[model samples]
Target: MEEFVPSAAIAHFVMKVKDVESSYAFYQGLGLRGIDKFPEMAIIELRGGTHLLLAAKDDPMAGALHASRVGQRPDFISEKIDLMIAGHTRADLEKYRAELMANGYSPADIAEAPLYGHDYFSMLDPDGHGVSVYTSHCGDKPV
Candidate 1:
């Protein structure tokens, strides 16, 4: 038997949104660049090489796409998905949180978690997906 290995890295993540335009605007507000627009989908480029595809849930193509996946399609709008982004330092995380707040994003109060060994904050997108920005470790604390 041979070990299975993936041929390539993940190029993008597809999020089935109730409204593509609203989701696109929400991500754009978070600083993601809109690369392309389609009738029922919008492509957004994040900081890294990965991209985010916001597709309208009711699009005809959505059914075909969901069928190809292993499990039932997730309800992205109301799902509890934690999209975490790493920050270089505590100050960096703090700055990001502040920026979101300044830009009309109401992120929850920052919290320190001993179990995770990090300080993090979370905010909800327009579709209600949870996005978290966190430092790997609490200041001077071991993971």
Candidate 2:
């Protein structure tokens, strides 16, 4: 057998949301692209060139696929996933966090960690997915 070589990469991350529409709106407000084709799935494009797939719990086709094919349990959807975003400085993250708070979402517990530098706060989207806003000051490097 020969080793497989890669050409390019495409990735999709799925998170379970109790209400797809609400989550869609939430992510959309965070400057994420693509929100119209929702309810089936809410897709958010991150600043770091990644995609987020917010899957609704009440979606029938999702249930069918998971149940019939994936052999997943009825409740096998994760409530959250840590999404890493990039910014140049702590102030940059703070500006965005303020926008998030103004939109009625609490960007909680700004903290500086040993691994990552002077970053602050995280927000739970309508679906309870944690969106982390970090800057490159407190830690040696961004993880």
Candidate 3:
């Protein structure tokens, strides 16, 4: 009998936003092409075949989805969520940072980490979720 190896990959990343439409617009401005849209939810495609699901806080499914995490704390605030995006090269990371800045997004200044062997920049989405753009070192060599 062959051992079953799980092929794991991120299919969708769901996030609760205060206003679905506004948050959708925010992501659209960042070059994420919208794949589907609904009154209380939206699906945006990222670069690496992963989809971002944005759900309105007031949506019923959103409530149920986060119910376990919230427990009895109705006022519980979600801890900072990091959405890391990878670029093909260091220049690609810098280009994304520059484009974000030019489009009025105030991303943190780019920084390099020797330990990680990559360059990265961080920014906050409309709902204050952390979004980071980076170029990885332990992957196919950059073109």
TM-score of each: 0.74, 0.68, 0.74
lDDT of 2 by residue, 1-143 (tens): 55554455445666668887778777788777863455487677765446777777668767643444354455654545554445666567777777777888777856755234445566677655567655654233323
**Top model number, lDDT:** 3
Show model 2 residue runs off by greater than 4 Å.
Answer: 1-10, 63-77, 112-114, 136-143
Question: Compared with the true structure, what per-residue lDDT tens digits does model 1 show for residues 2-105?
Answer: 65544665676777787788888888887778999888889998754578878787899767656665774454335433444456555767787788889888
Tens digits of per-residue lDDT, candidate 3, 45-117, equal: 8765678889887788677556554444556454234444456566787788788788888989777562266
Worst 10 residues of 2 by lDDT: 134-143
Where does model 3 exceed 4 Å of error? Answer: 1-6, 67-76, 79-88, 112-115, 141-143
TM-score of candidate 3 on Cα atoms, chains taken together: 0.74
Query: How much lDDT does each candidate structure score?
Result: 0.70, 0.64, 0.72
- Model 1 spans with C-alpha error above 4 angstroms: 1-8, 72-77, 80-86, 136-143
The better candidate by lDDT, 1 or 3, is: 3
